[model samples]
Target chain A: MENGYKLSYLDNLESESIHVMREVFAEFEKPVLLYSIGKDSSVLLRLAQKAFYPGKIPFPLMHIDTSYKFVEMIDFRDKIPAKENVNLIVHKNDKYIKKRMHPSKFGMDKCCKFLKTKSLLDGLSSGGFDAALGGARREEERSRAKERIFSFRDQFGAWDPKNQRPELWSIYNARINPNESVRIFPLSNWTELDIWHYIKKENIEIVPLYFAKKRKIIRRDGLILLADQFNSPKEGEEVEEAMVRFRTLGCSPCSGAVESEADTLDKIIEEVMIAMNSERENRAIDYETDGSMEEKKKQGYF
Target chain B: MHKEKDLLRLVTAGSIDDGKSTLIGRLLYESKGIYKDQLTSIEDIAKKKGEKEIDLSLLVDGLKSEREQGITIDVAYRYFSTQKRKFIIADSPGHVQYTRNMVTAASTADLAVIIIDARKGVLEQTKRHSFIATLLDIPHILVLVNKMDLVGYSEDVYEKIKEDYLQFASRLPTHDIQIKPISALRGDMVVKKGNNMNWYDGRTFLHYLESVNIVSDRNLIDFRFPVQTVIRPNLDFRGYAGRIESGVIKVGDDIAVLPSGKKSRIKSIETYDRKLDKAFTPQSVVLTLENHIDISRGDMLIRQRNVPEIRDELEAEVCWMAEEPMEEGGEYLIKHTTNTVPVILKELRYKIDINTLHREEKKELGLNDIGRVIIKAQKPIFFDPYVRNHKTGSFIIIDELTNATVGAGIIWYPSATLPETENSQ
Candidate 1:
């Protein structure tokens, strides 16, 4: 522990990520950061800024607004571009919004497809981005454990799991065809605990929804859904106000909340250390089947 | 606040049914790295498969095809930490067809954990994995003779396997080797010391992993920095941004930009957190020079007196990854450090037979074939021997047509003494 001359695990992870960020900036002609406005995205943004300090971020930040996001998330997302001194591109599927696509009306699968996946593809294609940097961590899920840091995608944004390129040492192969792209995950080696520790050490700002608060919620299928404007109580469903916080942020209807009182960063870290369930447990999208995330990732879902 | 823990990356390679997955699973489970929900899902799968006990291998075989086949297909990275160090396990398949995946895992690993079944002592696959572990210059190798309970925890059996392995590995270059006995299924000697193996007295697998000395594995004596990009925020501030691949750098140190032969003194070292007086290997920072030097991406910076070899021809060992066989005299892209240039396969010297460690004359290398080849680059590259520095001595081969990483190579050295025009068919 007295090895001050050597870097800690956190410092090493940060350095590795910064290296990746700079590589993406140098290797790709047109690259963009897929900002999700979640804790991971917030950390990723800080890393990007650190990667290119004393200078503006070399690429624009793109967010796919599914329209069902929490009001606080949207507000927080709107304020980042100005504060960070970077360009932000918010891609919303206006056609689907006009058609009134909702998870409650249409299924969560279809809603996620049109609102998130399709919008993401359209934004990237229209922007002519050859590479997209994301905040995906391999430790987050099962199938993600096998994903390479520089994940290659076909022209249609489909991931071929069986044909992953061999990533050796610190050397990355960023070469791709004109229409094909690569998903650069700088945070592939970081764990959830490492992320929280980093956020605490750097004092990075995050969405207030992560902290505990009194919010109206409904229990459905063992998941606590926020009973907000986008989602209300159904017939015979009781609406209750409780101290709940979200482990992950996504479309509010699809992301579940867990009951907790860890409002401060320290308390949240403590709870996370002793928590029983994994972070992705509350995510309803992963509950459809055994390899749902794999299926989604193959179809260009990030 | 807590003290920062160091990191160790290791790879586990073994043939099918060597309890590789179970051993990894046991380590994770016993260390409390496995969460409740993951265990529950595994239990559900185990019940559906009509198993009385939960299958620990299910935790690592994440993909559906892997589960259906009951074998690992590609490299799966698993992370876990104890109080002392953080570990990243590159779990790769042991099938002969997936040797490329094992090479990928070993490329960044400081240690290699080779699992061998005590019942089947030192098989050809074990030799293959050992040869690769040594060929890639892994600093440490721990051979775990797993399934000891199935072999009645016999000391003679363990010793026989260890002796056989030592005999085979005597010719390899890796000097740090440790052998132990364990039962992944019964949870013996993996994390906690079980009572069955009383005669075999040594550190358990987890204890050895936690306490191994890997600090000196990095090359800290030679400074090598390859500039990834130039940070030019404004006209007044221009800096070279890159990660120090090896050695260290400090303020006022005399440095030279490679291939350009321009020299300058370091003015300052800058990072997002704060300006540092000095920095070491693997740290990404922007460095400013006292004198203006024309340096951009793909340019290397090193000490003025200490420079790596600069040559356009290279003799190296290559592991072919693509399904299609290597085409003789084919042109491909060679990506080394931050530099990418056109390269041609000059000659295929020979391919090594993994089973016998014999060199065979071959014209082409197919998938998962290991061979020594001569390559000619369009431009001179600054590099050291792979044995001297892993960071600056490695490169990846990219197929020009498909953009796939067709090969992985470790440089022997600059082949300047070899005849340039002596082409052998």
Candidate 2:
């Protein structure tokens, strides 16, 4: 494959993401990877390793534990950092946690604010990170399609979508003021299918919750939710065991599940190829309103 | 799903009225890229607006303000895959004031799909978009003479529009331009090759996108790798890490480090998976040299004999992207390849009129303005003519105060070889 070498689309996407990661490493003084312990985050972790192989990752990994995360996700997160030999910072809004902020109690909007959005901003500020890389993709949501690969945030951690800087070519402008920061999305171009394809190709390890298995679940507002310790059935709601799997990972209450029998990577890929709707359809936070994602992004939600 | 398919990046610049979004929406719909839920959401939106037929443009217009204003403001990327290739569409706004957005979309595009309303003929916006496509060095251009059903599918009308566009494009740089007539609203010659135009023999739009020859578009002759960072795990290992901007490098090949002009031999090509014998364009890999060299980020590696120009002063065509005007002789940061250095806008040569392709005398460039400017860098930069290799020849200017990327530039000539002008200071 010397003279007539042609890079497949997966290869192209991988190389592009690796290039972006390296640029962030070279440009920013303090950078951190936002790990969510989901499939996208798992793929991002592998890419980061590939990007800085022969040397350890130049930066640490940060996770905003919402306290409502799946048990398996927390279990997987506990062992990854030491195994990969990278620093891990898990930040949670202790004040809100002590107050017992739940989606059902304070509404999904306020719960997400204190748990995920506020926690993320606090984590970035405390670490004094100039750049924070996330696993957001353009195809995931409508509003996300317009985001730049290197998205800028103001001192208040607010996104000015209308006044975004123009990103030309692969030359990302990472310059920011002392308090300002840029959200780098190396996986901006990767579609959901592409992520699965890469995971299959690279044999990347992912959370076991993704594969369909026997689990306790409850039906709420037309969504199948995991029935776990953090999330329990209400007075009238019934908790039953079913073969279900999660499409996305978020707070246990906000993340939805789907009934399936795909327990392997190849089976998951087949399910995704023919699956209707979208990966984000199961995300409860996105369905708050028509432009909820846009509003959340403007408020500095990842 | 396991088949090896390449990626193609294409850009389409037009407002909703021009049927640009419809064309893209049709491509995604017919190719099975649109999921059922996405279709249902758009269908529900169309019904709420009291429309009889489903509005395809609603599928591409993702933002709320764009949907309310009926115009695209920023660039939105959409992805789709067929049997042959996977495509990334950079859909940008087409209004005159959004020239900067168009340029941003075209910078990394391999093909530009220019949608011209058949009845409107070749408008100034059409010419402007096409001119930008060529200026950004896109290898291919597909001219979709849209709204053919509105124009009665007349061959004469199609011929006249094609001729007018060809005449206007002849004055600009040459590119592989293809012309086709279709009604994006009626789905003619877009995906299904509808029976509305039996006289046309060209391939459908989707077919053209899938079959376009983009592999040869990459510059494979010049080996240039700008080191992003140096990897040193321990005392026993040291490697130079970078993505091959162009060409190929194999182990045991002679390589030269730029800026310092140091020479070394390729000792081993390393990757995360395994050791590689060689690497080609766009592959991110680590290379260890046979001899230790004092190399770091911002230094480029190239073939010894095939060297790029090392110059501190250069002339470039720039597109001002910021709201503030570009001041002549003002200092800013210029980032090229992996190097970032302070630069001064030495002179404002002339701004090009986007509509007529004519140069005008201008003291400074305002937002969305395109102009030629001479820049003087604090340190010499390795470069090539933008027409030769895009990776090595392009740069971006950052505002010193705001730290915003204010302008994107393409190198034209090194100032040392440029003829002296009377206005030169």
Number of colliding residue pairs in model 2:
0
For model 1, residues B1-425, the per-residue Cα lDDT tens digits are: 33388899999998888888888887777666678998898899888989998877788887887888877788889998888888999988888455798899999999999999888999999998888988899989999999999999999999998888898888787468999999999988988789999897899888999899887877888999999999999999999999999998999999999899999999999999999999998899999999898999999999998999898989899999998988878999999999999999889999999889999999989999999999999999999888889998899999989888999999886555543432210
- Report the C-alpha lDDT of model 2 over B31-85, residue by residue, as the tens digit: 7667777788878878888987887777777788878887778888999888789
Model 2 spans with C-alpha error above 4 angstroms: A1-3, B1-3, B415-425
- The CAPRI category of model 2 is medium
Give each prediction's DockQ, rounded to 2 decimals: 0.74, 0.74
Residue A35 CA error for candidate 1 (Å)? 0.6
The window of 10 residues in a row where model 1 chain B has the poorest summed lDDT is: B416-425
The digit string of per-residue lDDT tens for model 2 on A271-296 reads 98788878978888887877788888
lDDT of 2 at B245: 91
TM, every model = 0.97, 0.97
Candidate 1 achieves a global lDDT of 0.90
Q: How high is the lDDT of residue A111 in model 1?
A: 88
